[model samples]
Target: MSLFPTYKRFPLTIVSGSGTTVIDNKGKEYLDFVSGIGVCNLGHRPPHVQKALEEQLHNVWHVSNLYQIPIQNEAAELLTSTTNLDYVFFCNSGAEANEAAIKLARKHTFKEKILTFKQSFHGRTFATMSASGQEKVHQGFGTLLPTFEYLPYNDTKAVQDVQDDQVAAIMVEVIQGEGGVIQGNKEFMEAIEQKCRELGALFIIDEVQTGIGRTGKAFAYQHFGLDPDIITSAKGLGSGFPVGAMIGKEKLAETFSAGTHGSTFGGNPLASAAIKATLEVIFKPDFLQSVMEKGYFFQELLNEKIGSLSVVKEIRGHGLMTGIAIHTEALPVIDELRDHHLLAVPAGPFVVRLLPPLNVSYQEMKRAVEILAEVLDQITDKTINSD
Candidate 1:
């Protein structure tokens, strides 16, 4: 059988990657700003991660979850110690982590409904797909999982107006990575936590794309200083290795005991090794500070380079989770960027998503912006010529 025809795959075929750069089979060099859709926060095949994986390969790889794994414990410790989350349940992807979080919320609260926002994307699983607020994603899927509601994102008044006690959780992305890089309003985000407290509902932050220092913070929720009840994370957690985690406070620990939730390959020795190595690098105080510095530097460069474009609306995001909102189509702009040997992805109809590596140097950041400037010029020229 042939492979299923899915995903409007990009035309480029990558051969190998080093740091923030990749090579196509045609031997063309590209500065990868996609970061594997925010998975390679540390860039591809980082020396430390490669070394860690090699060491684990020489030892044991998979040991199942029947027995305790010290490396898993180490990985868990790194997360718990770093964030307000008291406990962690390892899974295999952002979707699994979100599914686990949903299960825990429903189980713990004994409630049926979840509250999400418009343009929010959790995952592709039945439950997560149902949780997503975008209609396009739910168009083809018949019989989605039940009990979900949507609110306008970053609207404090909408949050304040909530009167539903049936809301098991309020799941939100600090920065809607897939929703055109839409950011959460600080006041609204804070109000969500307060409302959750008043309603006795769980507060869930979907940090699948913003965690693991993608936002120059260990977790993007920390930026708002709101303490969520449950946080789902993946993508960059393992620095390109497949690993996810659902972190929660200690009070709900009893709800997920034993058989309620699990995964056979979630925290295997190999995955744990990848996580530990990634954490060791990004979790360093100096390293995170540097990320913060780099994030500002990148945004500043973009602002100075492309600020005058009429088609461009704005460049906004926290840390490296940046986006360029435009009046015209972003697809052509993204294609133009690719032609210039710079890789970027589209966030929404009018948004060009830019998720550079957290460790991408200021010089590389500047060059990427310069390349973007050239692409914008081409886009403008094309529009003029067509007219």
Candidate 2:
């Protein structure tokens, strides 16, 4: 028996992690800027989460959603309290959270079409994959779910060109993490929200990658000051535990009543335990303030160190969710960084994505910036010689 080869496996294999660092099977240590692709916001094996899980493990683990699961209700409450969204529907992953949002939009609006942005990534599920603007994800999967449209992300012109009653929802990412760290323009977001209102459409914000202090905010939607009818979250929701949530306004959430939606393993006791622990740490004003401060410092450091390199095109991001757009192929730099014991992932074609844990120290940020500078300097030197 063998596992499915769904991912393009990296060369390295990690054995364990503590704080913002991980050790590989070879006993080599690497600074984990990837943070499990933004899942370990509190870092690996956080004490609070560990204790919570242990306490829950001693109690019941799984139960029917039929009875009152106090912990499940508590997790939902924690999520709803963080954002403008009134209620929550728990699930297992970002894709599931997004799927729930899609279903809710259609049911609440009594409409079909869902509008998304070009280069945005929702998830890998059928509806979310169809909703994704990246065509590559849809390559082998023929016949996606119907009535989904893709428009230019952060394009105000697209906002002007809308038809009445044509869309059930206009889904967006405040910062398109998988789209090479493209940040949404303020005016652009305002336009989308206004358009959704004009067309009687739901505004859905996919914060799967940006939520839970990844961008120094409870939800990136909070940065825009625009209220969304629906917002989906996952990635860092449970500090690496597999948990997700689709949060929405009370009026819209009410449409998803008995038999309309349900999840078997979603919000089980163990998952809820992790959620409670993760939320307790991140929801604090001081913790989020520290993230905001560190994000500013990290972006400044990148500009100071790598801004002048010929291969560097731009650096864009808010808080810890940063991306560097380089001119040359990004793989060599990624490999070089790994060799230097720093781990970063790729976003789109030519960008290096940086998603350090929210609790990463200032000293760790300096180390990551130093490694990036060295690699980029070498690349620039090579390019100049070749030229």
Q: Against the true structure, whose TM-score is highest? A: 2
In model 1, the clashing pairs are none
TM-score of 1: 0.98
Look at candidate 1 and tell me the lDDT of residue 9. 81
Go through the candidates in order and give each one's C-alpha lDDT.
0.92, 0.92
Q: After superposition, how far is residue 212 of candidate 1 from its true place, in Å?
A: 0.6
User: Which stretch of 10 consecutive residues in model 1 shows the poorest summed lDDT?
Assistant: 1-10
Candidate 1 per-residue lDDT, tens place, 62-107, comes to 9979898999999999998888889999999999999999999999
Clashing pairs in 2: none
Score residue 14 of candidate 2 by CA lDDT: 96
Highest lDDT: which candidate?
2
C-alpha lDDT of candidate 1 relative to the true structure = 0.92
Please provide TM-scores, in order, for all candidate models, with all chains considered together: 0.98, 0.98
Model 1: CA > 4 A from native: 384-387
